[model samples]
Target: MSQYSILAAAVEHRLLEKNSEFITFLQPVSDREQALHWLQHYREHYKDAAHVCWAYIIGNTRQPQTQAFSDDGEPSGTAGKPMLHVLTERELGNCLAVVVRYFGGIKLGAGGLVRAYSAAVSQAAQQARLTLVSPQSLLRIAADFALEARIRQLLAQFDATLLDVQYQQGVALSVSLAAADLASFKLQLQELCAGAVSLTEPTA
Candidate 1:
């Protein structure tokens, strides 16, 4: 896993093209299931809309683990493809972009439809709040009760998240930290405890 950007929250943007209303919805998603949930929610909420075009990218943006798009009733390569291109070019992952169209008695040619959908998603993305997330791995450590406080301090120093603690026999801790930080964290812990702390496979 690698670092990537995802939407921090949902956002909405609207555009008008030759009287056609285009409503763009931008949302952060962890997987395909969450993306589909949002798509279905919007479809049911906006049942009367002319079309619902959507695209989603999960995992790494540069080389997404999963991706899909739907143009709904729009012409092939018009709505969904253009919207997906915008997301890919922006290097966004774990996110979904949906465009809802309300017909206004005008037809946008294939090229025009592509431009409209792409622009709608682009503008919405510009306004969306984003957060960069790094991949993490779990680790378990066992130390004497006397070293528990110092071990906790080391965990904080390394920015590791404490997941659990057990007091049986000695102090046992489970934590999660960025994979990049694991080596340094282990070295520091060894030095601090003088090799008294034992590292083990993550419990969870």
Candidate 2:
């Protein structure tokens, strides 16, 4: 996957339009199933809500693999669409957004509902941390035990994550790092391990 932003944690924002209360929540999700799971949670939690509107974007936000939204019972195009607009405008993906409406008596006409829902999500996103997710490639390396420390240092410098390690005549390590960093990382590893290390992708 290409680099993109995702909510680092769940965020809640509140907005009042006329007498309606829009409680919006944004969460990071891996796929459609996870997004639906969270939508169901909010729906169950707010059984009395007038509407449980939701939207989600599953892959690269710019060129999404999947995207959907629902206005629930609100006026067509009033709630869910605007909420989704905010998310896409911000270039966020792998995230779910749910807006629970608590009717406050007065009805917010179509335009009003759109503005209210959009602002709710936009504000919540402002308050929440957005984390950039970079695509990672897995690599396995075998090196002498004596060179372990230097190898680890190189991995750290390249923002590589050590996933596993096995010890035999030497040490075999599984690591993951941003695909963009692979070339530079391999060069640096070559310099550090000289002719003593072997790096290869794990066999499927």
Candidate 3:
């Protein structure tokens, strides 16, 4: 199976109201550094907001660590936790949701806070969109000079990425193919080079 990480830029939106606040769901992100970086970037953007409550899920898909949220001064659990829940319910990973409260004067109780925060993340997520990512590996093939032309022709048949060619090293040819296509690619390379090409597979 292919492995991939999600990023914050994948989903983002802003909601603003004098009374309520704005909720922004960032794209999927991995690790603490990236998450903090995004937080600082947006925090500066909405520095004037009353409070910036946020949550994130960092860990594996099967067992995600809990979230971190704050009401900024609102009742606890009103803002951050709910925003995190929205991301969880959607089965999103490596994501962070930041709700910048502008303090609408009227106090939204815990329930009201939850509803608003949840709605913010959900709406942003809905607007953001989801995408699939895949892992790809590279396969290097070293072939005789006479066979390079045929190998290049065969490579064109598939979605292969060529890395480099070093004639100094006995017609060295490097190409990248999806990890899933490794077996088939090897078979095709063997046939194209008539057993004269050496193949190597490297994980990405």
lDDT of 3 by residue, 142-197 (tens): 87788888888877887788898888757887787666777888898887777988
- lDDT per model, in order? 0.91, 0.88, 0.72
Mind giving the per-residue lDDT tens digits that candidate 1 earns over 101-188? 9998989999999999999999998997878888787899998999999999998898899989999999999999988888899999
Question: Which numbered prediction scores highest in lDDT against the true structure?
Answer: 1
Question: What TM-score does model 3 achieve against the real structure?
Answer: 0.69
Q: Model 2: residues >4 Å from true position, as ranges?
A: 1-3, 58-60, 63-66, 104-107, 143-150, 168-170, 191-197, 202-204
Q: Count the backbone clashes (under 3 Å) in each candidate.
A: 0, 1, 7
Q: Which residue pairs show collisions in model 3?
A: 6-28, 7-27, 7-28, 8-27, 15-22, 19-104, 29-94
Candidate 2 lDDT over 1-204, as tens digits, reads 568887778888898878888898999998999999999999999999989999999877888879999999889998889888888988777889999989998877888888888888888778777888887889999999999999998889887999999999999999999988888888889888886899898643
Best by TM-score: 1
Q: What's the CA RMSD of model 1 in angstroms? A: 2.1
- Candidate 3, overall lDDT? 0.72
Candidate 1 vs candidate 3: which has greater lDDT?
1
**1 or 2, greater by lDDT:** 1
Give the candidates in order of lDDT, highest first.
Answer: 1, 2, 3
Model 3 steric clash total: 7
